[model samples]
Target: MNAVTRLLRDLVAIPSVNPRLLGPDVETPAEEPVAEYLSVLAKKHGLDVSRQAVLPGRRNLLVRLKPSGKVKKRILLAPHMDVVPADDSQFKPSISNGRLYGRGACDTKGCIAAYFHALCQIAKYKQRLQHTEIIFLGLIDEEHLQSGSRAYARNGPKADLAIVGEPTRLQIITAHKGDFWWQLKVVGKAAHGATPHLGKSAVHQMARTVEILLTEYNDSLKEKQHPLLGSPTINIGVIQGGTQPNIVPDTCSIDIDRRTLPGETENTVRKEILDVLKPHGLKPDFLDLRGVPCDALETNPALPLVQRFMKVARRRRTLGADFFTDASPLASAGIPAILYGPGDIAQAHTSEEWIDLTQLEQATEVVKRFLQEVES
Candidate 1:
C-alpha cells in the first residue's frame, strides 16, 4: 500500500467521533486521539507542530513547512478531524474492490492523509520554497457547531489562501450553499377531544402553514437564483405536536433547514417566511435553532492563485457544492477559501463509507504538484 493510504487507515482506526452526536451516558473517544497522532507524526518528520486549544479536551493541530527564504505568501491546507458517530466496527478500516471502507474515509480523513502526505513529500525532497509557506491544519468540531474553525478564524493568522478539505471528487469548488436552522411554533387553546369545536387546533393551523411554505414559498425561492449555487432551498426536517390522538394539540412546532445562498441573511429569510404566512393570519413564533451563522462560500475564481491551482488540477471549469463546509467561516474571516479533495460526498457518513484508492493517490499527486509549482 502507498504511504497516503496507510496514513488514512491509521487515521480511521483512531476514534475521533464528535462528542455532540453522542448520548449523555455514552462514552466515546473524541478528536484528541487523532490530534495526538498527527502531532507525533509531524514531529517525527522534523516539522514545526503546534496545537490551538479549542474546547477543554479538544485542540486543532497545525504543522508548518516554512519557506527556505523570506515568507511572502501563506497557503493553508485544512481538513476537519471530527467524524459523525458510527458503529464500533466501522472504525476498523477494511479494503474491498480497490476501495478503503471505514468511518470518515471519504468525509475528510482521506483529505487529511492526502494533504499531509503531500506536505511531507515536499519536505523530504527539500524543495526550495523561497516565498511560500504551507500549513496543514487539522480542525475539530466541523460536524457540530464548527467552534474549532470559528476559534481559529478569530485568533489564527490570516492566510492568503486556504484549501478547506471535503469530499468533492477532486473538483475545485469555488462556491457552496450555507446552512440555517430555526423552529416555528404555533400555539392554541386545549379542550376536550370529543368537542373539537371547543378547542382550537394548533396542529391544524401548522399543517396549512407548512403546505404554503412548501409550495408557494419554495417556488418563490426559485426566482432568487445564484449563477453558481443555483438557488436557495428549504426543507421541513422535523415536526412535533400533540400528546395523544384524542387530546387537542395546544402547541405545534417544526424545525426548518434553510439552505441560504450568497447575500441571504437570517433576517431576510425570516421576513420572507413571515410575509408568506401574513395573509393567512398565521403568525407562528420563530425560534433560532442554530447558535452560529453558517454563511455561504463564494471565493473569487479570478484570483491568480486560485486560477493557478485550478490549472494544476487540470480543471477547465469551476464547480459548486450544495453542502456547507469550514471554508465559509474562514472566508468570512477575510481569507480566500475553496474546497478540493478526493472521494465522493455520497459516501460520507454512510454505514459503509469508503473511498476509491485511485482517487486517493491522484489527490496526493495533485496537491504535491500544486505545492511544487506555487513556490514560484
Candidate 2:
C-alpha cells in the first residue's frame, strides 16, 4: 500500500472516541491512543515533536519541520485527532470499490494522512526554500469541546498563516459561518392535565417562543448576506419539556444553533433573539454552557501564503463552508487561517462514511506542490 493509505488505515484502526461529558454512562476518553500513535510517528519521521496534555492521557501533539538556517514564514497545518462516536458496525476500517470506510475518514483522518504523507516527502527532499517552518498540529477534542485547539491557541508557536485540515474536497475555503450555540430554558406552572385552566404549560410557552424566533429573528438574519457563505441560518436542534403526558410541564429546554457571519458575535445574536420574545412576556434563561464556542474564521484571501497555495494547487475558485473548525481560534489570534483539505463534507459523520482513494491521491499531490511552492 502507498504511504498515505497505510497511514490512514493505521489512524482509522485507532479508536479515539471522546468520552461523554459527566454522564452516568460515560466511556473512557478516546483521545489518548491517537496521541500515543502520533508521538511514535513523529519520532520515526525524525521531526521535533512535543505534546500539550489537557487531561491525564489526552494530548495535542505538535510536530515541526524546520529549515537549517534562518526562516521567513511559518505555515501551521492543523487536523483534529478525535472522531464522533462511530456505529459499532462501522468502527472497523474496511476498503471496498476504491473507497476507505470508517469513522473520521472523510471528516478529518483523511486530511491527517494527506498532510503527514506530504510532510514525509518534504523531509526527504529537505532543501533551502523560502519557508522558515512547517508545523503539523494533530489536535484532540475537536469533535467534543474543541479543548485541544483552544489550548493550542493559548500557547502555540506563532505562525504567519494556518491551514486547518477538514474535508473541503480539495478546495481552498476562504470563509465559513461562525456559530452561536446556546441553551434556553422556559418556565411555567405545573398541574394536572385535566385542569387545563389551572396550569400554564411550559411546552406551550416554548412553542410560542420558537414561533416568534422563527418569524422575527430568523428572517432578520437572512437580510445580512455573505458573498460566499450566503446568509446566517438557525436550527432548533434539540427540545425537551413535559415528563409525562398527564402532567403539565413545569419547564422546557431547547438547544438553538445560530450560524454567524463575519461582523456578528454571539452576544449580538443572543440579545436579538431574546428581544423578539419580550413582547410576548417570555423570559427564558440563555446560557453559553457548551465549553466549545464556535467563533467564525475570517481570513484575507490576498495573503502571500494563501496566494502561493492557490497558485500551486491551481485552484480555480474559492468557497465557504457552513461547518465550524479550528481555524476560528487561529484567526482570532490574528493569523490568517483557511479551511482546506480533501474529501466532501457531505460524507462526514455518516454511518457509511468513506473517501475516494483517487481524491485522496489528488489531495496529496496538491499538498506536496503547495509545500514545494511555499518552501522553494
In terms of lDDT, the best-performing candidate is 1
Stretches > 4 Å off in candidate 1: 194-198, 244-247
Give the TM-score of each candidate: 0.95, 0.90
How many clashing pairs per prediction, in order?
Answer: 0, 1
> Model 2 over residues 58-121: C-alpha lDDT tens digits?
7888888887768777888898988888776666888888889998888789988898888878
Evaluate candidate 1 by giving its C-alpha RMSD to the native, one decimal: 1.6
lDDT of 1 by residue, 146-190 (tens): 888898899998898999999999999999999789999999888
C-alpha lDDT values of all predictions? 0.92, 0.82
Clashing pairs in 1: none
Q: Return the lDDT, model 1, position 28.
A: 55
